[model samples]
Target: MGLIVTIIIGFFVGLIAKFLMPGRDPGGFIITILLGIGGALTANFLGRALGLYSTNEAAGFIASVIGAMILLAIYRAFSGRGRLTH
Candidate 1:
């Protein structure tokens, strides 16, 4: 139950992040959810390692969005598929 809730929250977090940073990416509801969850995980892991976030704390909404945006930036830089072929 808790895990399901977490996923739902992650989905929304991803949606909001994507909305905030609209960019080229393979996108859909599923992808958004995955991105969000991945971002949250990334933020949590890095924050804990850097002592910015405690182990018991999950990443905040803003942090999660920022993480997602960073991931999106990296994806944009590497994926190289969004070039508008004219």
Candidate 2:
């Protein structure tokens, strides 16, 4: 149940981040969901390590979006794709 909730939140966070970023992102819904989930998890770990968040706490919307963007950027860089743009 908790995992499901986290995924759902991550999905929306990914979509929102993509929308906000206003760029071309490779992949479809599955990719978006994965990106979101990855971003959330990354943020969660980094925040905890930095003492910016509780161990069990989820990241805020903005942080999640930023994380997603960063992940997306890294993906593009590794894949030799162009930068994302509106």
Candidate 3:
């Protein structure tokens, strides 16, 4: 139940992030889901570190999207799949 909800939300988050940051990304549905989930986790930890969220609190939607975008950027940099485009 909770997991399903998370996955669904993650999918949307990933799609939104990708749409916002236009570029050639790797993988498909599964990667999108992972990206979203990873973004949320990144936001959670980053928020906690920056005192934006409490220990047990989660990140907001906007923050999650931002995090996802950051993750996607990093992925593209490391994967070298979205560079050198004319």
Candidate 4:
């Protein structure tokens, strides 16, 4: 049940991140879901470390989206992609 909820949230977060960033990202639904989950985890970890969020709480929607964007940016940087244009 928790995993299902995470996936659903991830799906929407991925969609919104893609919309907000507007770039040629790789992968399909599975990839997007993975990205979303990764983003949420990253946000949660960072938020907790920075005292922006509680340790036991999940990241908020906006934080999740921002985290996804950050992940995308990191991916682009590592892959040598200059900018996203799509």
- What lDDT does the true structure give each of the candidates? 0.83, 0.81, 0.91, 0.86
Show pairs that collide, candidate 4. none
Q: What is the overall TM-score of model 3 with all chains considered together?
A: 0.92
Task: Please give, for residues 25-61, the per-residue lDDT of candidate 4 as tens digits.
Answer: 8988987887888889889999999998886788988
User: Any runs in candidate 3 off by more than 4 Å, and if so which?
Assistant: none
lDDT of 1 by residue, 1-86 (tens): 98888789879888888888776668788898888988888899888998998869988888888888888878877887545567
Top candidate, metric TM-score: 3
Model 2 lDDT, full chain set: 0.81
Show the colliding residue pairs in model 3.
Answer: none
Q: Which portions of model 4 miss their true places by more than 4 Å?
A: 83-86
Model 2, 18-77: lDDT tens per residue?
A: 886666678888888888888877887778888999866878877887888888878778
Rank list by lDDT: 3, 4, 1, 2
By lDDT, the best candidate is 3
Model 3, 2-83: lDDT tens digits are: 9999999899899999999998787799999989998899899899999999987999888999999999988888888658
Candidate 1 displacement at residue 63 in angstroms:
0.8
Clashes of each: 0, 1, 0, 0
* Candidate 4 similarity to native, TM-score: 0.88
Order the candidate numbers by TM-score, best to worst.
Answer: 3, 4, 1, 2
lDDT of 4 at 53: 86
